[model samples]
Target: MVINFGAGPAKLPREVLLEVQKELVEYGSSGMSVMEMSHRGTTYVKLHEETLELARELLKVPDNYKILLMQGGGTGLFAAVAMNLIGRTGSADYLVTGSWSAKAAKEAAKFGKVNQVVPKPAKYTCVPDPKSWKLDPKASYLYYCDNETIEGVEFNFVPETNGVPLVVDMSSNIMSRPVDIKKFGVIFACAQKNIGPSGITLVIVREDLIGHQLPTTPTILDFSIVAKDNSINNTPPTFIIAVVGRVFAWIKRQGGLQKLYQDSLTKSNMIYAVVDGSKSFYYCPLEANVRSRMNVPFRIGGPSGNETLEKEFLKGAEQLGMQQLKGHRSVGGIRASLYNAVTIEEAESLRKYMLEFLAKNS
Candidate 1:
C-alpha cells in the first residue's frame, strides 16, 4: 500500500522481492542463505558469473566492454574515475547541469584540475550544446550525470565530446530506458535506485579505460585491478548482487529495454499531462525539453508559495496510501520517483489525487 518515492534505496519489483524472500533461507539447495555463502565458493562464483552475463546481455553491451560488479556507491566512482583517468593529463571536462554532476566535478577537482562547462543561462532548460563545450584536448575523460534526481533534469540526447571518452553517472536512471552502450567509454550506477539494493554497484567500462590507475589509487578502487580479476579481488555484496540478478531476470521477462523505454515514456507522459492540464494550479519549473521521466518535480503554486502546499500534499497523499511524495531538502517541491518498478496505474492514481487536492485546496 506504500508508494516509495525516495531517490536511492527506492522501491523494488514485487516479484524480485518475493524471489529474494523465497531464497533467503536456502539458495539453490546450498543449505545456506546467499549472505552466508563464501564469495570464493563455486556456488557464489557461478552466481556472480551468471549475473554479470545477464547484465551484459540485458544492456546489449558490446564484447569490448567489461562489466565490473564492484563495491562502493556512485559517489565512489566519482573519485575512482578521476584517480584512474585524470592522472598524467591532470585535467578533465565536466558538464554541470544539476546537483550530481556538480558533485562529480567537485570530486574530480580533488584529484586534478577540472574544467566545468556549465549550461548557458538561456539554455538551462535544455542540454548544453556539445559544440559549445570547451573540451581540453589533453583531458582524459568528459564526465556528466545522465539524469539529475533532485533537479528532475535529464539529457534527452547524448553529448558529443569530439572523441573524448564519456563517463556518466547513471545512478538515478540506469535501466529505466534503452541506451546505446557504445556511446560512452564508461557508465557507472549504484544498484539501489533501479537495479536492486544499496550495497552493490554496476560499472560498464570500455576495455581501453580499464588500466592506467594513478599510483595513489587504492587497489580496490582501481578499475583495472577489479576488471582484471573479474571483480573478485575481495568479497562482494553477494546478497545485493543476487537480488539484482533476479531483477535483471524480471526485466528480461517483462520485455527487455524496448518495453521498459515505452513503459517509462507512457507513465511519465500520463503524469506530466495531468500536471500540464492543471493550468496554473501546479508548476513544473524544470525546462520542458530536459524534464526527467524517472523523477518528476513539481510545485503546487504558480510562482510563489510557502510550505503549506507541500505539507498538505504529503498529508493528503499519506491518507490515500500514496507515500513518500515529499521533495528533496535541497529543492523544496514535490518529487515522485517513477522508477522501473512504478506502474502506470500508481502514477495515474497520484495524478487523480493531485487533481482532487487542487480542486479542494485551490
Candidate 2:
C-alpha cells in the first residue's frame, strides 16, 4: 500500500474509509445516501448533531462553547476571524510564526490595525520569544496558528494573552493531541488534515465571542448566525460531516486523544531520529524544540538543501511505495506529514528507506 504524506487532504484512517464506504451508497436504513439527505431532515440533522457531539466529547469542549460546522477552509477564516472579532477593539494582535499566521495578519490588516507581536523573520525556523512580543492590551484578540504545515513549526505552549481573547488556527494538528479548549476564545480547524475531508471547517467559539462582528460581515461569516442556527444556516457539508463523524468515532475507539498524542510522538520521533542521526545527509530547518509533530519538513543535502539530491530522494521514496513526500513548491525539499491517520508502520517504512538511502549515497 502506498503511504500518503500530503499536508492537507491528507490520509484518513483506513478503518474510517471502510466505514464510510459501507454507508456511501445507502446510510443506515435512511433509504437515501447521506449526500442526498436534506440538512433539515431528521437523518442528516441527527448525523450533524452527533458529529458535533463527538467532536465536543473528543476535544472536551466546554458547554459554553458553540461548535459550528461551516463550509470555508482555513483561508476563509483568516478574514472571517478579523471581521467577527476586530470590531471589539478595531484591531487585533497576531503572532506571526510562519506562513499561515503571516497570511492571517495580512488579511486582518484589511479590516483593522494588525500589530504583529514580533517582526517577520528571515526564515520560519523558530518562534520568537514571548517576552519580546509587543502585545496590544486593547487588541480585540490574540491570533496564532498552532501548527504551520509548510514551515514545519508548531508552538510548544499556548501564548498567554492576559485577559484578551485567544484565537488559534489548529487546522493541521487539531485532534492529534489533547488541548484545553477553555483557554481560547475561538479554535478553528480545516477537517482535511487530522479530522476527515476538505469541505468542512470546524469552528469552536466561546459563547460570549459570538455576535461581535463588524457591521459589514456577511451573514454566513457571522459566527453568531452560524452558531444560533446550529450551523444549518445553509446547506451544510453533509457528506463531509458524516465522514468526520466516522473519523471521530474511530478516534474514540483508539483510546482517545492521549493515545493518539503518544502515537504522534512515536511516529514523528521515528522519522526525526533518522534525520538527526543522518549527520549531514538530512537536515530539518526548524528548531528542535518547535519541530512540528504532524508535518515534518526536511532537506536532503545539507542546510541549504540541494534540490537535485532532494529530488532523487523523493524519486526513491515514490519507488518504495511512498507518495506525496515532496515538500511544498514554495520551499522545495521533503516533508512527511504524520497526521493522525498515518500509521506508525508507515513511519517505520519511511525511516528504513531514509537510512538505506543514506548508506547508499553517503
Candidate 3:
C-alpha cells in the first residue's frame, strides 16, 4: 500500500517484487537464491546472457552496439569514459544542462581538456539551441545527460553533431522513454534507477568505440575488455543482473518501449496538469519546454511557506502510505520521481492529496 517516490533505488513493479519473493529461496529450480549463486556458474551465466539479450530487445538496440554490464555506477563510468575516449589530445565538448552533466564535465577535466558549453540563462531551465553550442571539431566526443533528475530538465531533441560521436549519461531516465540508440556512440546508465538494482551499470557502446582505451586505463575499466569478454571479465553482479532480467521481461510483457513511452507521457501530463492548476500555489522552476517526465520538482511558495507546506504534505501523505516525498538535499524542494513502477492510480492519489492539501492550507 506504500507509495515510494525516491529517485534511485526507487519503487519496483509489484509483480517483479512478488516474483523475486517467490524465487528468493529457489531460482529456476536451482534451489538457491540468485545472490547465492557464483557469478561464473552456468546458471548465473545463462541469467546474465538472457538479461543482456532481453534488454537489447526491449530497447531495440542496433546490432552494431554491445551492451556491457559493468560494476561501477554512473559516477565511475564518467571517469572511465574520459580515460578511455579522451585520448592523448584529451579534449571533449560537454553540454552543461544540469548538475549531473556539470559533474561529468568536471570529472573529464582530470584526464584532459574539457570545453564546457554553458547554456544561457545561467541555470538549467531549458536546453540550449544546438546551433549555439561552441563545439570543438577536434574534440573526442560530445557528452550530455538526457535528463537532470534534480533540476527536472530534460532534452526534448537530440543534437545533430555532424560526424562527432554523441555520448550520453542516461542514469535517471533510461527506460522511462524511448530513444534512438543509433544516434549515439555511447549511452551509459546506472541500473538502480530504472532497470533493477544498484550493483550493476549498463553501457551500450557502438562496437567501433570499444578498443580505444588509453594505456593508462585499468583493464577492468576498459569497455573493450568488458565487451570482448561479454562482461564476464571478472565476477559480475549476478543478483542484480537476475533482477534486471526480470524487469526486462516485465517491460516486454507491458508492450515494449512504445508502450512505456506512452505511459510515461500520460503520467507526466497528469502530474503537470495538477501542478499547473495549482496557480501561484505551486511553482516549477524549470522551463515548460524542457521539463522532465520522470522527475517532477516543484515548490509551494517562498522558503518559509515551502518548508511548512512540504512538512504538512509529507506528514499527511506518509499517514496515507505515500513515502519518500522529500526533495533532494541540495535543491530543498519537492521532487516526485515517477518511475515505471509507479501506476497511474498512484499518481492520481498524489494529485488528489495535493489538491486537498492546498485547499486546507490556502
Candidate 4:
C-alpha cells in the first residue's frame, strides 16, 4: 500500500475514497455523477446545503459566522479579506510568520496599507514573540497563517489582536484540530490540504463583516456577494464540495476535531521522536514549541543537511511504498506531512524508515 505524504492534495481517508467510488456514477439515484449534475439542481443543492451544515456542526461555528464556499484557493482569499474588511479602517495588521503570511501581507498592500506587526525574519523558523509584535489597534484586521506548510512552523497560540478583527489563513491546518470559532472575524482555508481537493476555498467570516467591500473589489471576490447567494453566486465546484462533505462526515465519524487533534499529536510525535533521537543524523530547524504538528521538516546528516543522504532517504522510502518525503524546493530536506488522513500506521512506518536509514548511514 502506498502512503502519500505530499503537502497539498495530500492523502484522503481510505474509507472516504471507497464511499466516493461507490457513489461516483449515480449519487442517490440522481442517474448522473455529481460531476455531471448541475450545481443549482435539486440534487446538488441538497448536497451543498448538507455540506455547509456539516461544516458548521463540526467546527462549532457560531450563528454569527457564515461559512462560504468559493473558488480561488487560499491566495484568492488573501485578496478577499483585504477587499472585504480593509475598508473598515483603510489598513490591516499582519503577523508575518512564514512564506504564506508574508505573501498575504504583500497582497493586502495592493488594496490598503499593510502594517507588518513584526519585521520579516531572515529565516522562517519560529513565530516571533507576540510581546514583540507592534500591532495597530485601528487596523481593520490582523492577519496571520495558522500553519506554514513549507517552513513547518505553526502558531501554538492565537495572538491577541487588541480588538482588531483577526483574519487567519488556515489552509494547511484547518479541520486538523478544534478552534475557537469566535476568536477571529474570519478564518479561510483552501480545500486541498486537510479538507478535500484544490478547486474550492472555505471562508468562515462573522456575519457583521460580510458587507463593506472596497469600491474596486470584483463581484466574485466580494464576500458580501458570495455570502448573499449562499456561495452559489456562480458555478460552484460540485465534485470538490461533495468530496469535502464526505471528508467532513468522515471527521464526525472519527470522533470529530478532538480525536483528530489527538491523532495528530500522536502521529507527529512518532516521527519527531525519531528525528530528535537521531543525534546529529537528523535535525529539524524550528524550535521545539513552534514546530508544526501537521508538517514535520527535517534535515539528515546534521543541521546544515546532507543532500546526498536526503536523496538516498527518499529512494528507500519509495521502495517501501512511502512517497513525497522530499521537502519544499526553497528549503531542501525531508518533510512528512502528517495530515488528518495519513494514518498512524503510515506515520509509524515513516518513523521506522528514519531510524533504519540512520542506522545504515551512520
Question: lDDT tens digits, residues 120-234, model 4?
Answer: 7789998888889998989999999999999999989988986889999999999999999899999999998899989999999999888879999998899989988999999
What's model 3's overall lDDT?
A: 0.86
Better of 3 and 4 by TM-score: 4
Say which candidate scores most in lDDT. 2
Kindly give the stretch of ten consecutive residues in candidate 3 with the minimal lDDT sum: 301-310
Q: What is each predicted model's overall lDDT from 0 to 1? A: 0.86, 0.93, 0.86, 0.92
- What is candidate 4's local distance difference test score? 0.92
For each candidate in turn, the TM-score is 0.97, 0.99, 0.97, 0.99
Ranking by lDDT: 2, 4, 1, 3
Give me the displacement of residue 83 in model 3, in angstroms: 1.2
Q: In model 4, which range of ten residues has the least summed lDDT?
A: 271-280
Better of 2 and 3 by lDDT: 2
Give the per-residue lDDT digits (tens) of candidate 1, residues 1-362: 88776777799999899999999999988999999999899999999999999899989999999999877798888899999888847899898888788888989999899998764353234566677777787778889889998888899988877788989999988987888999999999999888999988899999988777888999888999999899999888888889999999999998997898899898888788878988867888877888999999887887444478878888989988887788888777788999999888888898888888878977
Candidate 3, superposed: residue stretches over 4 Å from native: 119-122, 302-305
Write down the lDDT that model 1 would get. Answer: 0.86
Question: Candidate 4: how large is its RMSD?
Answer: 0.8
